[model samples]
Target: MSIRDGGGTGEVAGRPRLAGPPTRLRAPPAASRPGVGRAAMPNAPPREFCTFYVAPPLLSPYFSVGGRACWEIKMRIARRAQRLAGTLAILVSVASATAAAGDADPDVYLLIGQSNMAGRAPIPDDAQGPLDRCVLLNDRDAWEPAANPLNRYSTIRKDLKMQKLGPGWGFAQALLAAAPKARIGLVVNARGGSRIEEWKKGTRFYNEAVRRAQAAMKAGTLRGVLWHQGESNATDPDYLDKLKQLVLDLRADLGKPDLPFVAGQVAKDSPVNAHLARLPQTVPGTACVSAEGLKTIDGTHFDTAGQLELGRRYAESINKLRRAE
Candidate 1:
């Protein structure tokens, strides 16, 4: 008789259906039998050895022995999991401590002024000078290394023929060289060919600088404001008085009655006669630079060499003022 005559089988309609391959219901391998520990589990199925998944529930008392064995296996797995978690926590803590130690010191600086103080030099080749603590405020207003050796304000020359090298970058390098321990920051807001009229009491440029100065003062520190502009309003005879009023407004607005100001006299041989136009800002501070032989052949802007020297002169003036204070 067929095995199905005595044993019930799953049936579809009146025909009996096989319970699947007999091999599927065969007992586990001898190596996976009870009393075999983890030390002898090399030949066991992965599911029986690994604790990553839940085991099938044991419903019969015959399986009570299996249930007790499962409990012991689970305990060993839990202990190993706890040990791994603790190791991970310790590794994370150590990594954080190392990062914090490396960031113990930081540098900061502020750069503010007119077009000259905004930078107009060409990008220097091999400008890979070491900057231990210097940074530039990029065109996007993000802080980056001052390694470009050229400033964004210089891009104006493509449109405006009158643009030339200003003293901003030279000044920055000088400060970095003079105080390598300090961090540099630039807060530039200069308009090309802007006159005292445009920068006067009710105007935006002047007012904005004032507001920035106030904010800087609240922080109790401001490097200084470098002034390299004056040709635009030098033609006015009353430029001195207007400049004095401007100084008053700037100081009052910045909340510093005697804030340090750095000024540079124009180089004289300008083909455009821009040098002949001189305003009182030329003599505002005690450290005005003499631009006698430094004018470019064009009689307007400083050439590469002239601009570098101009920067040096400006830095010297600033150093003098700083030393006095």
Candidate 2:
């Protein structure tokens, strides 16, 4: 396999450089009402942790107030507190569970981009099998055994076949071989025929990727990301800018400021191959793998052999990055 880096200034056109420390999300205030001190509700739902609090009503009933009125006011406050407490309890439990799971050092990689990343190539009979050590984030938002066609949850295209060999399995296998003692998890979030513009911070596709990555992180450490796109935006001059922002946003969202990002070049005959090759020069903590000699089934999607090779190249790039660190 041949890998080439196009020489260009690190700066991306029409995009400002990210500066300062990464932004952190703050928890919501404990109390929304003034003079109403908040305290944790007692007997929160079983097995569920909660941060909910009961707030004393802003106004207290005077001694002269009617007994019924005072009782009614107290009941209302109690009911509201119960509901809020239940909701917060569930959230706290989930958060705690996620935190606990994320403490493990399982090696996790996120796969994102268009068709190639989603695995459009047909699977050969011999290669049709399961990886015992590989885990995938499946359609139901749960981690299960890694299977062929790594990305099967995408709603972007219904006509596309959901079952076919993809690079994710190969990539996972390569990772397992490199680190036999480490647990491997693959977060597949690619959509077919998606443009870079659709992968902006707030876009559905981008949010989904972030959500899946976050969930996957709960099960392992986010080591790197594998990207295979650009065919859709091959002609857009600002494609590099959009891609840069996407990478920056992903890093920020994943809370891994220096996460390794590996991008794969399109097929040798693709019009966007040149742009794809420039990823290393345009993005930091990133490298590009060449698909120069890969055999494509339809001049676009790689065949099973090509997919396996691509996965190996991605693993190699990631290993190189880890060593450099």
Candidate 3:
């Protein structure tokens, strides 16, 4: 009944025992063990998913495996292996928890601008199914599967039927293509005929966009911004200054100094195109995507094909900006 630990040969404390050897203690069952119990982490794969295996000890020529059979020794070795498997299981569970946390917080993107950004083109028949690892911040400030008419959730948006495919759709797809495992969140808040002046900080248009962005940030981090306005301000020479201020203000308000801001040109001929072209030159973390060959449905808004292409371009630009910083 009394016990003291020593070399397997402890009569009392440190010496060899009068008996052949001290009895070995067996481990508890896997179900009762601490870490190897089960897939305890939320959203974690089952225990069977990350199991560790040990080769049978009866297969080796130089080791006990395939050598002589000893029940007590074999049981002790089996218990040690069980503990090892339990530790590995625990490590895998912790890793799963970290991945789930990341899934919970998505990569939020803010899309804002005028009608063009709101997408005036008609939805194509081949529009794909729900994007993998992507979600849209709905008008009610809730997250749902990202789909066509990404601007539908715009708090200051127009009629539903008018909502069509925009760069957000393609942008998300292209972004996912680059990093397949990443989760994307879109927070679009654009109006039909708004100009740069309307989107100025403190205005209702600007306030609503910021509000939605902040709300979405609760479940995700603001990763990038996509802008496609300037059709209304094409002739205004002061558009560049306002855009710079807008970008700066947004970065300040959103608390991401180096936040990537990408502005898409409305049309190749628009005067604002020149200003948009020069954005990246003036701003620190900004880039401009061209709509040069992109055909527009109404000589203003990008058509379905053009919108999708521009979305891919936006993804490429954002990736480069992140790398440059």
For this target, which candidate reaches the highest lDDT against the unseen true structure?
Answer: 3
**Predicted structure 2: lDDT:** 0.65
Write down the TM-score for model 3: 0.68
| Error of model 3, residue 315, in angstroms | 0.9
Look at candidate 3 and tell me the lDDT of residue 260: 97
| Poorest lDDT segment (10 consecutive residues) of candidate 3 | 58-67
Q: Is candidate 2 or candidate 3 better by TM-score?
A: 3
In model 1, residue pairs whose N, Cα or C atoms come closer than 3 Å (at least 3 residues apart or on different chains), thus clashing, are: 108-183, 109-185, 111-186, 111-187, 269-299, 270-299, 271-299
Best by TM-score: 3
Q: Please, what are the lDDT tens digits per residue for candidate 3 over residues 1-325? A: 1112222321111111111244543453453221122322244333332222221222111111111211221211123455456555644653443343333467889999988788887777766555667778776576666777888878789898888888888898898888866878888887888889999999999999888888888767888899989988889999999999999999999888999999998865989999999999999899999887999777878888998899899999999998997
Clashes of 2: 1
Q: 175-267, model 1: which lDDT tens digit per residue?
A: 768876555554455666667676687787776666544433332245556666666655666655665566666666665566566556655
TM-score of every prediction relative to native:
0.56, 0.65, 0.68
Worst 10 residues of 2 by lDDT: 64-73
RMSD of 3: 17.7
Return the clash pairs for model 3, or none: 57-65, 58-66
| Candidate 1 lDDT score relative to the true structure | 0.45
* lDDT against the true structure, each candidate: 0.45, 0.65, 0.71
Question: What digit string (tens of lDDT, one per residue) describes model 2 on residues 140-233?
Answer: 5445556676677553533546546777877888888988766677888787788888888999888888887787665467899898898887
